[model samples]
Target: MSVTVCLGSQFGDEGKGKLVDILANNANLCCRAQGGNNAGHTIVANGKTFDFHILPSGLINPKCINLVGSGCVVHVPSFFKELEALEKHGLNTTERIFISDRAHVVFDLHQLVDGLEEAELANSFIGTTRKGIGPTYSTKMTRSGVRIADIFDPEIFESKLRRLAHGFQRRFGELLKYDLEAEISRYKNYREKLVPYVIDQIPMLNSAKEQKMDILVEGANAIMLDIDYGTYPFVTSSNTGLGGVLTGLNLGWRSIKEVIGVVKAYTTRVGSGPFPSEQLNEIGDKLQGVGQEVGVTTGRKRRCGWLDLVIIKYSHDVNDYTSLNLTKLDVLDDFEEIKVATGYSFQGQKLESFPANPETLAKVDVTYETLPGWKIPTTGAKYFYDLPVNARKYVEFIEKAVGVKIRWIGVGPGRENMISR
Candidate 1:
């Protein structure tokens, strides 16, 4: 009966899918709040690995209804491509799935613009997944965008496309130095394919609420990557924070009962942005190797670091975190001593809080508290108390600092490896 929304505490790839796949059992519906193919939620179910960018993570629960809320931008090729790929793993996309007409359509031009902009930047790329997320969001906000509803009415669809093409033509000419008419003509086939998933979403999401069924409001990317709160001028296009749930669902803030923040025991970030605790040592490489920490969507190697309680506290503040699901705890098993960043010192100003400016944050020296490594493996510990003494200590230290209970701990990569508090 409750609507719980989960988002990443640090950067994305915080094992949200694994947590959602577990919580999905108690829910009847799951809704995607924002983002597109640029965001990925990887779930390992039944020995088969599936990562979805545009679809809801609750798809694993066949009985639970899946929804794509109005806040998302769907790139047709990636959406259907994901559906087709899932077929190989044996899942039917019958009545179990639904797309909101309120969602914007991410066209080929969006991807082209993303690439063109990044290509224009060359060495200074923002590490975008190039999934047309930024441009689509821009268009939607400008009210010059194409929505799922446009597809049902050819007049509106073509009209929006014409305007989008004209706008991009100017951008391409002035910015990317590429002709867009030829590119726009080439996407006719994709436009034809995207028609079915488009719809008016107010009726769609409201229908779920009327039934009193649970709808999990899912998000992509992380709160740290949010353009507003994250490192600005180097952040993603959309808001990937808890506020996205209200915008995506178009519901009152009170509708959401809980916000579950997911974080990796060790940190990993993709693309270009400021990383506070990145380590270039052999231990950092070791953690990456054991966790298989690679970008689920891009296959790019991630920047690795230690557990940063300072960033965790900042995330809790922005997302209003109700509880936390700490993932990849087992990745820290081998190190003789594990370091947790409890505080920071910037410009002779010692602080227990996170810094505001990237310049100050990047220069800040870390204040750490090293703890005994849990040499014993927690591969099958299902209860919090059952964890090795050091493992329990690590979780407790983070809980005490953040003032939030560690609601769940992920011992290993598999879904079944998770243990509830």
Candidate 2:
């Protein structure tokens, strides 16, 4: 009968799906706060792996309800594609899923523009997923965007699309060509197909709160990729933390009871950003190979590095996580030693905390604390005491540094491969 907000403490792909999948069992409703199809969650259930982009993985829980809130930007075609894909897998989503009508929709033009924008900055590309998330958010802020509700009314949808097309054509008329007439016809069908899932979720969520049902808010990207808090320009367009959950779901702060921050045993980042602790050598290769560090959205190889306590400490300060979930601990089994970044040094002077500026952050040198590796597999450990001594010590070090209890540990990819304390 409580609400829990689960988010990533690092630069996303922190194994949040597994944590949400675990928590969804007890929850009645699970809502996605911010982000779009650019973020991906891979979940393993019933010996099958499901990759979720625009949908909540909580759908794996038979009795849990799912909501795509107003803070998200929905691509109608992609949304249906996901639903169709799930339905093909025998997952019936008719009554279990709901989408906020206030959610902005992403058009094909947005995706084209996203690619064009990235192409223009080839030298310093943001490494976007090309999912049109940034452009969709831009239109949403500019008040020229189309909402899910507008799609139900053809007149309103056409007017908005025309106005939006005018701006796009004026800016990149020579660079891109789009047939608005065809798009309109196609979307009319999409609207009909999506009508059932669309609803005003704010009141529904509030009503659920009044009924004292457990609500779980699953955050998309990690705290470091938050538009305002993360490394700017390289970050995602929406807030990906506690503040986002409030704005996304239209929920009061008092509705939340706990915030769980999920972090990997080692650090990995997908795309371009200032990674202070990136290991570019044998250790990095080892972690990458063992952990299978690949981006779920883009299929790009993730940059691997040692565990950085500096980043987690900063994440802890921002989100104030009630507890933590440590993932991929089994990936470190073969290592003889493990390194954790405890501090950063800039200009030969010790830095006090994580620097805000990307340039300054890029230049800072990481100071590491070496710990003995367990050199033993910890997959499917059922309890905290089941971890090897060194593995337990590693989790303990993080707990003391971040001042949050390690409530769960992800030893493998499967839903059952975890330890609860």
Instruction: Specify the highest-lDDT model's number.
Output: 2
Provide the RMSD of all predictions against the true structure, rounded to 1 decimal: 2.2, 1.0
Q: Can you write out model 1's per-residue Cα lDDT over 277-387, one digit (the tens) per residue? A: 888888778877988988888998888989888889999999988999999898888878999888889878897667668778788888889999978888888898889
lDDT by residue for model 2 (305-345), tens: 99899999899899989999999999999999999999999
- Counting only residues 3 or more apart in sequence or on different chains, how many pairs clash (N, Cα, C under 3 Å) in candidate 1? 2
User: How many Å off is the CA of 366 in candidate 1?
Assistant: 1.1
Model 1: pairs clashing at backbone N, Cα or C within 3 Å = 101-199, 101-200
Task: Score residue 36 of candidate 2 by CA lDDT.
Answer: 90
What do the candidate models score in CA lDDT, each in turn? 0.82, 0.91
Ten contiguous residues minimizing lDDT sum, candidate 2? 374-383
